[model samples]
Target chain A: MSSRVEILNDGGYRSDGRRQYELRDIDIDLSQQGTADGCCTITHGLTQVLVTVFGPKEAKMRSQTLHDRAVINVEMNVLPFSTGERRRRARADRRILELAATIKSTFEPVVQTTLYPRSQIDIFVQVLQQDGGLLHACINATTLALISAGIPMTDFVCAVSGGVHSTSPLLDLTTLEENDLPHMTVAVMPRTGKVTLVALETRLHVDRFADIFRLAGDAGQALHKEMKRAVKSRATRLVGAMETGMKPPMGGADAFERDVVMEDKMSF
Target chain B: MISFASFPVPSQNETQGMTRHHPDVEDDIDMDEGFEEGFHRLTSPGEPLTSSQAFMRGHGTYIDNDEVISSVAGTVERVNKLISVRAVRSRYNPEVGDLVVGRITEVQPRRWKVDANSRQDAVLMLSSVNLPGGVQRRKLESDELQMRTFFEEGDLLVAEVQAFFADGAMSLHTRSLRYGKLRNGQLVTVPPALIRRLKSHFLSLPCGVDLILGLNGYIWASKHVKQSEQEGEEAFDAEAVYSNKNDDIDDATRLAISRVSNIIRILAAHFIPLTDTLLLDAYEWAVEQEGDVKDLLQADIGDAMIATIAARD
Candidate 1:
């Protein structure tokens, strides 16, 4: 490769100092945003995305209503400052529309739309920052937002990006590595081990696909643990508040300790 | 072969933990034991609850491979052989014989579509309403043409869910004199879960203000109407009931209505369940503070009010 930055060093560390197959740290915030029914903001290292779910309510347009199930509408907006170079994109940008359509199809089979016939569920996704794995973060954030909104879903969809740097398979790649390597994003429903989405933008050797695919699946399970922990804690705090009639402490100390233990268990 | 070093294998303890939480497995230890009343068994989507052979699935749950799994992130509730999960935050789920405040969204030929904060716009049929001439009078064809005269677009009214259509849309009725157009009030919306059912949804305070707590999370606070002026079927004045003009609301009553509305808003922001007793106590607390009605919305003041209420409880 003619790039000045090294994708992988002699010691097996990447440019960001993460070893092969190491995932970026994830931070999730599940807080009420404005009047949305459910909202979530997730950060995968420097990449950040906020998702808000509005309905299961009446459809705005009569033509969009489905007689047997709810219609899912996804709208995505990438802020002009999200990328390294400052640029403005139109509301109907071709790339953004395609991304929104991809997300809508990914969730269609998972959400239990039949429960609310003749209704609509609006999912608004805002991309705050972009590093790499933008699609992965959007999918994960949307899942959390839908859960928080109390929408019925068969399972949680966890996603991660993987790439083959030369012959070594890397998990959760950054923009630098993504530019130099052949990468793909994979979303999995952890419980049933169903692959909901597999998006590949760059070409890769057929032989290398299986290895990266399996690695991404395993990484999704790890990410599932992180998301589950966040959902459980938020649920517990809300239940506690409702029961005791007081504001529950922010992420109780015991909960934080348990998270640490879980993290230790995850690191093989 | 390249070794997959980063991923952790599902350990024995983790697998056991899953089975241990299942209701059927827990049943074996104590046949007579059940979840404590008000105890919340929090669960997330796809978390298996019990074997379908031993329990029946309820709302927020689905049967998959002979197992009952939750489909939302909420508390697990059990009633005898039925298991269900109640989602913490969702759109209002309507039931029969419940009071709701709604705004007219569309005036159809014979029905007025209402925004009841539910999954679909509730239908209010012309036949379900009290005719202007009399309670039992037949509806004339001319009435259908002037539906807007009674409930034009954007008019707010309080009604009860009378029935449901085959498509799950709730039908509302305003046949009773108590249920009709709302005026001289402000509407405040909150999560439906915060409003609970009570003996009477219509509440009056000593401060010359009245409140209608719609189970659909639509709260209306308005000036108190004297019981004597609230006409019965004998003296039903259709002109007054469907009047577009608001009565003369004095500055004192107006201030009290705003104060009570603010209190309700603050309590809802704190996620506290609203009840008649709670509202009365909150109103008294606000008056004792002697601050402007707008001050109750201040973050610190709201926190103080919640803390005060919690301590008293």
Candidate 2:
């Protein structure tokens, strides 16, 4: 109703003070929450999503059990207060169910389900807050949670939202920008640079689609770098804790040299 | 209450520097120094570990285009010609004869589905359990009708992984008297990886607590049951074994059991490998503090407890 708010200002800066291609700050927390096998809380600026993965365990419903491989069940909940308006959405809301279905399909091929036969993998995605990019955050957090749960996945999936504001394409659209622009979310597998998901809800000019898609893909790769670092850092701490007694037979000098190299690379 | 401190701001570079340097200082003189070196050698999912021809792919790994790539984000382990990556946290992968404590989720014909905190519910067949009359008694159709009388839904029991079914679901057997309905205790779960294998999974502490360390990370701490008492009624105690009764546990025994369970919970929260010695050391340290059992969960007290346990090593 209010068309006075500016998404992209005349100065080439977005309303959130980010440049056209700049992404929002990403924060991830993989600490344990309850008895979930693995769980992660991820934030993309104002959007926050917590995903917990349980199983490759027994399926509660025998009818849903797959004989040749594992079954994936994804359930998503958007809190009433997650959006600007405090609106309560039903569990079977069409939009919410579609979102959950899209996420399940995105991860189906990536997860090596055949490795686990006659079991089920449950992914519970909770959207605590949202500005934009809800699907992107959910998909990304699910990927990390699955890895934490030790379910084998072919690769890490990184996602980002991109939109075209008039002629200038924007990366990581916020809710305000999303309302006024034609936006799409893209999820990419960093290892193979394969696009796992490309979700476009708004219609844009045919010529503009290729540009936004390529930009989202490139942004996905950048997101992948940050996500990979967080996962590897946590893995290092845990693996170190498990291997305390077996000090490298060589002197501390060799190990220190290796750490220095790691440090140098990490400095970037 | 949601705290802001829980969400550390978006300083990736600064946080990375801090994390790396903090471990750098601790690795040199820490008892767990070897772990730090190993951590650096860990692999992320999809990272090529080696050629498929040279290394056989194991769990947490897959053969992709003639290259063995990691399928989980964790440390790569090589045994003989087989290579695998072990995720830091995961569901318990049960092996034959491993001890486990599970809660019955459902009761079906001749079989009870037990949630063992694994990838699937482990199967506990009617024949796998000893009937109240005798171990040698035949499992008649009448026994099938009274399956709920044996191990009903929501009943927790201790059993061993009998074998694997055609589908990979583990079949558990509770035929042994020692492996039967669990009572007089509470279950505490931790990450499965933290429970290292020991010669004896059952431990009776001098503090009047009995500990059953299930490899599935389902630990049971209960009031100590004397071995002599067990032997005296060894025969014809099938009724007691199948009984859903909790013998009157005195206040003192209950307190001791709770204290030991709390200690295990604390140890698990810190990701410390739980061994009998470690638990013994932690129990002694907790008693020395002379504080309330609940105080052990406080952050400062928990830190001090971890420090005292580490100091002992």
The residue pairs found clashing in candidate 1 are: none
lDDT of 2 at B164: 97
lDDT of 1 by residue, B187-212 (tens): 98878988777556776667878788
Please list the residue runs of candidate 1 whose C-alpha ends up more than 4 Å from where it truly belongs after superposition: A246-268, B1-38
Docking class of 2: acceptable
Off by over 4 Å in 2: A1-3, A243-268, B1-40, B232-234
Evaluated at residue B41, the lDDT of candidate 1 is 82
Best by lDDT: 1
| lDDT digits (tens) for residues B1-313 of candidate 2 | 1111211243678565754334336435333323232334567788878899977988889888899999999877777787878888788999999999999999988999999988889999998987876668888999899898888888999999999988788999987767889888888887899887655577667777888889999999987787656622237586677789898999989878878888887777767778666777778888888999888777678768877777765
DockQ of 1: 0.23
Q: Give the TM-score of candidate 1.
A: 0.89
The sequence of per-residue lDDT tens digits that candidate 1 reaches over residues A42-116 is 999999999999999899889989999999999999999999999999989999999999999999999999999
Please give the RMSD to the true structure for each candidate, in Å: 11.6, 9.1
User: lDDT of model 2 at residue B66?
Assistant: 93
